[model samples]
Target: MNLVQLKMLDAIVRTQSLSKAANALHKSQPALTLAIKKLEAELGFELLDRNQYRLSLTEKGKLFHREAAQLLSAQSYLTQLANELALGNEANFKICYEQLCHAPQYNDIICDAFRQYQSTEFSVSSGKRFASLEQVNTAQADLGIGPWFDLFHATGDLESMPIGKLDIGIVCANNLVPKRVKYKQLQDYPCLAMFESEMSFDSERLSYSKGSAIMKIDDIATLKSFLISGAGWAMISLAHCQSELDSGLLQRVEVLDREHTFSAQIRVFRQYSVHHGPVARAIWQGFKRASEQFIND
Candidate 1:
């Protein structure tokens, strides 16, 4: 009828006596007898044979006991799993990173975290521009690695630590633009910009030039494709296009404007919440250590 009743039945069948079962279970003999009686009455079948000298299970009792044992085992495992979760063992950990933050050190850190928490499922995804920040802020991801912008500082809900700096400059296909191109001259060619819902064409920052033929791209890979095809010039992270630059597939365009080249702090961030689990915390600490080593180097 219930776990208590099923347990009493189990103890009675095991000990072969109600008195002994009561003593083993720390319940009164009368209480054990009543529990069995109630269970038999509820099931419309006797679980114990009264005619036997030593108590033995009825034929139906054997089948019920077998199934009840499985339930007890499942209940035990469930209880243990709940306790583990309560202690901050995450079952699934998700991480979102921007394309610029795709470095070997970061991959190593994530692999280390996965090895440390082998039972936890780890998911890694690449996002464009501020996509990582949006994912972490909206609770779509547990952790995020991306370039830190001043706007992120204004969002008090996020806790971030700078991991390193990424150099971003205007780049285009070889021979696509003049070596010493003026800022205004860039408007003659199409300009590629990372697509953000709130992005404005009026801003001169980050490759957005006013009066230029603007091409909005959703991801870094596609933007690189366009750049390689000489579709346009864009502000891109040097780290992301290193191989291309090395092979002369892409070339950095020198701009007369001083702000053409700048360093952005790459950071790991998470939403401020008490619900962050042990695995997430470990990964965050790993990033912090990596950041320290990067700074020292």
Candidate 2:
């Protein structure tokens, strides 16, 4: 009859035993029995058959349980709407970034802003270029930070803010490899590619050279590992592999500029469904300021 009594019945049906339902709900067996009996008395019908060792819902009980579940769902939705209006996301603030985006700026924007909103949990993750964009579009992410490729600029119902720019560099590993290899010659070797964990959209095309053998990995760190092992080659931002390049563990492929390498526009974005919360807004501003200050360098 009442929501509380309905919830008690729902639990009883789920666990299939009054004692088990009491234990699950952390209420005394006497209290749960009285609540259910109280509802049955008001309805002029029995909701459960007491003869069975395990709780079994009567035909009337099954109908009431369906309605009870809908009520609970509505309550949850109302609570979420209230939280959104107040701009307090009790759930985790999730933002996905592509590896090519500047890390320092991301750190300052995310870590620093999250500290200010200590009550909320923060989740940081990386994905392939297009996946980051899709996360924002689908509202799985509060924001997506990554290089600005043509796919991003062309996306509808999404808003973007430029953070910085990075040159796409073709890199290979080890001292044994020559200073420069012809673009076409790379076709014989395995080419490392960054594949998105979620396959929503893809616009990745042949750049510099086409590889005959492609090995796709979803993570950048893993791709770097393959590159360092001399397993294959990949196009990554020079900044990400700078330390390895300096240590002689990796080298730029040194292909001619005419081969169509790209300079990427690093940026951040959010969807058009709703405005970002205060925490997300602060991080966006911080990212812009960091870009102007060259914090990425």
Tens digits of lDDT, candidate 2, 152-204: 55564677777788887778887434556665666666778886443324545
Candidate 2, residue 8: lDDT? 89
Model number with the top lDDT = 1
- CA-only RMSD, every prediction: 19.7, 11.6
Pairs with steric clashes in candidate 2 = none
Where in model 1 is the C-alpha error above 4 Å? 1-88, 197-207
Tell me how many clashing residue pairs each candidate has. 0, 0
Candidate 1 lDDT over 1-297, as tens digits, reads 788888888778767888989997999999899889998999999888889899998899889988986676567557646856775588788899887667888889899989999988898876556778767865568888988887775653788888888898899999999867788898798989876632222133644577889888878889999999999899889888999999999999887875688788889998764355678878988988987887887
Segments in model 2 whose C-alpha atoms lie over 4 Å from true places: 1-81, 85-90, 196-211, 256-260, 291-297
TM-score of every model versus the real structure: 0.66, 0.65
Residue 203's lDDT within candidate 1 is 34
